[model samples]
Target: MTEAIVIAAQAGRALAEAARRAGLRPYVADLFGDADTLALAEAYRPLSGRFGSGPAAEATLAAVDGLAAAAGSPVGVVLGSGFEDVPGLVARIAERHRLIGAAAGTVAALKDPHGFAALCGRLGIPHPSVATDAPTDPGRWLLKRVGGSGGNHIRPAPRGTAPQGYYYQARVPGRPHALNFLADGLRIEVLAVTEQWCAPTPMLPYRYAGAVVGGASEASSLPAATWTVISDFIERIVAATGLRGLGSADFLVDGSDWWLTEINPRPGATLDILDRRTTPLLAAHVAACLGCMPALGAQPADAAAAQICYADREHAPVPDLPWPDHVRDRPRPGSVVRRDAPLCTVLAEGADRQAALARLETRTARLLAVLAAKKTHPEEAP
Candidate 1:
């Protein structure tokens, strides 16, 4: 069998590792080419582009074609983050290779602000009020790019001149929640519900921080009405979008009221929490994308949390330090890292969501301190 190809802005390390556990060699294309991901992938190519902006579609196509030729057959592609802005490019890629996720048309519908809102209205799914024009009160609304992912394109509205391809959404107060589900176009299977948080910095208030996955036991504590609302909304969305394969629905949950925020039509960051080696998620993602609805086995009992560690200030990358086993996504040495840019991802686990999140927070703080201290005394670092 030809190896699977995974592409994203930063090719997901979790996804690449899951592909390996699924017994398939993965050829990955992305911008970062992080150390761990490169080690796991059969071959790695760097994607040329910035996040939030559209992907480098031409470079991706060239890389995929080369990989397919080297493999002696056409390899299936599992697209990730950056394609959200380039549905046309996705369509072009699908025309040449087998795509293992939402088709181009589906992506267009989900990523289009007006189209998604209309779909939600048709299906009676509760969505926040959205408008094409900036609101009178900037504090009451947020400006969001139509195809932005990773919270990079969101900001308080009524600020300086808004960027192109932006729309305004009524700001709602609530904790962020994401529902990871697998679908076979018509049917939907709920995999896990994760609590997501933003690590605010001076430059970006909604910078994606991390997520705690699973936590069904913890979710049970919410009002019964909350589950009903979430379930009904998920069912309606699947029916309306005809989404297939690994996907997630982002929500802002304030008490029992839930507001649909965004639809992620590909494997998302929450994969770190839901991955089980017994039934690796990448294999399931591919299977679902190929028109099969794989069974969602029981979620793991222990919840997992993954946090993005950001650089506090402009710093020259330190030499090797005693990074903990849980650390991944480390920035390369001698690289100049800007403030608020992600330095690495730290992972931790506990029996429940709160426990996992707390541990992750503590671990993250310690890691940041270590990084800071190591910068001061590079000779002490290993």
Candidate 2:
């Protein structure tokens, strides 16, 4: 069987499962060896690292080599979250295996605050102003790491000089939206536009909460002029960067106006919600990287949403409760989960975005309630 390597922080399960759907045996390496991931993967290696920080490069490459050695000649490596900040490491991996997504240089250029800002300026895109130094009025700016993913890397700018590897961005007021698309270096096919919400903590106020895929209603909500501008922005950026495979362009939208914020050069959190194609998106991603843009299947009729269920308190050892079919990224039983850490993903579908999000809230509440009861009465736990 044809094989492919998948790597990410938590959602490698989604990629591994997609690879299987694409008729490819997947060799997976990620921080979490969740039960589902282990089952879906042909061979799994647990990488050691924090969530935002890409897995330690040496260990990751070693794991990749080990997986490649065990499997037949793999097609290529499909990366997900956690690699954006470490382009040198990405280049190292590309040396050994074909990378089935954006090149390391593309990631480096897009992740570089200054470079990306300059590109936006040249392209005449409405992007937030970026600077290495902190703004005089810190409250009007946000501090962000050079290559941060997830909302954990963002915070309100502080006084004085910006720290090394961090920069200040002029804060823009709007709701967060991500345009997930597929590209073949020159052109792109827009997949879905997801509305994103945040799960805020004291320290991580911008922590990613969830996203809802609104089909036609979402399209009608935005003005045609706004979409034209967005499409132009994507075209210009792709033309300049040669971005390939599955990627998402993030934007802040208020009324009819929108500002491009960031571009994720790989499949992102929305894969769970947007991977509704008959031909698996991973397959299309590989094809796109190989310069073939496959036709995307119809969008789902019903709205869908995916939310991260974060631990409210530390679970010394997570109880072995039966996880529902709607839940994903299930942590191993008896594993310790720190407070504020992601427990699992809760998914829901409904007739529309509001309904889908409402169902997500209910499912999240029910799951949390079960865990709370188990914590209070250990013997009552299943």
Candidate 3:
């Protein structure tokens, strides 16, 4: 059983599921303990409360090594969403094991957003106007963090506000798009092209004003041009950044101009969501990491869109998540449910985004109400 390691329990379980479907053994590792967690590979999403210390990094390294020894497999590390600062740590892990994603040197290429915009311009890719200072007209200048994911540290720049070591880009008005690409360290296999919708408001990290991913129209259903632009952009990104394995890119479509957005160098929250609908995600990631490229298959005409679910009213524990049998990513019993932690999500496929959004929303509210009531009364165990 070759082990595939993932970070954090939720993400680990997702990748593990994908790997298992593709005939590979999955292993999960994290600072947090889980009996349900797999045992073959040492991968986990960091529990920020548990083992988050610098200078004493040796202990963490030793722990990873111990797990690798026990599994009898060289670890293939998949960097989690929040582990952006630890490319060196990733490199160190790969030194003794198998590395699946981009190397530390390539990741360091994106130390600043302004430099990234310059790189895109050099490559003939459309990019937004960038400056260190906020433009006088605040209509579109967007403040972006250089090495952040999930829209963290992102805000709309106001006039006269000076941002430090960040990028202020001209916000182009258009539909948001995402491309989940799987590269075999050489060739391209665009797993899926998702038409994205976002909330029409300023975003706060982890808060759902509307949706980071409002809705999606799968690539197979849309115009072939959508996929063409997306494939070209992925090639440009790989050539510029030297990235491999699981990576997703975001772009803004403003009329005819498709402005480039930052690329997420790891599997996204939507990765498994798309995988649940299409080709095997985790298996493909592990295969690509080992230098294999899968076929480019079209998705269903109406694969359900991945909508972000957040709490507006006082959020309470979902007592027993009456999750539809189809939903994955089961939250632990003691996990906190707030704006920061997503309550739950759903998959809806139909003619349009409105129908899918509504169905997921109804299911989320009902299931969460049951969980929230238990948070208030723990004595009333399910």
Each candidate structure's TM-score, on Cα atoms with residue i matched to residue i, is: 0.93, 0.96, 0.79
Per-residue C-alpha lDDT of model 3 across residues 261-316, encoded as one tens digit per residue:
76776777675456653557766776676767765355545445555454443444
Q: lDDT (CA) for every model shown?
A: 0.77, 0.86, 0.58
Model 2, residue 118: displacement in angstroms? 0.2
Candidate 1 segments whose C-alpha is farther than 4 A from its true place: 1-3, 51-55, 159-162, 214-221
RMSD of each: 2.3, 1.9, 4.3
The residue-by-residue lDDT of candidate 1 on 1-382, one tens digit each, is 6455644445567777777877777777777777787887777777777433235566778876776555455348788888887888888878988888899898999999888998988888779988876466788889898888888778888765456788988898788888778887887777867778888766678889888774545554346677666766777777777778888989888876778988999988877768863678888888887877776676777778898888886676645665688888766666667878878888988888778888988998898888777777767753
Provide the global lDDT of candidate 3 against the true structure. 0.58
**Model 1, C-alpha of 66: deviation from truth (Å):** 2.0
Q: Could you give the candidate ranking by lDDT, starting with the highest?
A: 2, 1, 3
Q: Summarize candidate 2's per-residue lDDT along 170-271 as a digit string, tens digits.
A: 999898998889988888898877889999999999999999997644454456677667977897798899999999999999987788999999988998
Local lDDT at 373 for model 2: 92
Whose TM-score is higher: candidate 1's or candidate 3's? 1
lDDT of 1 at 123: 82
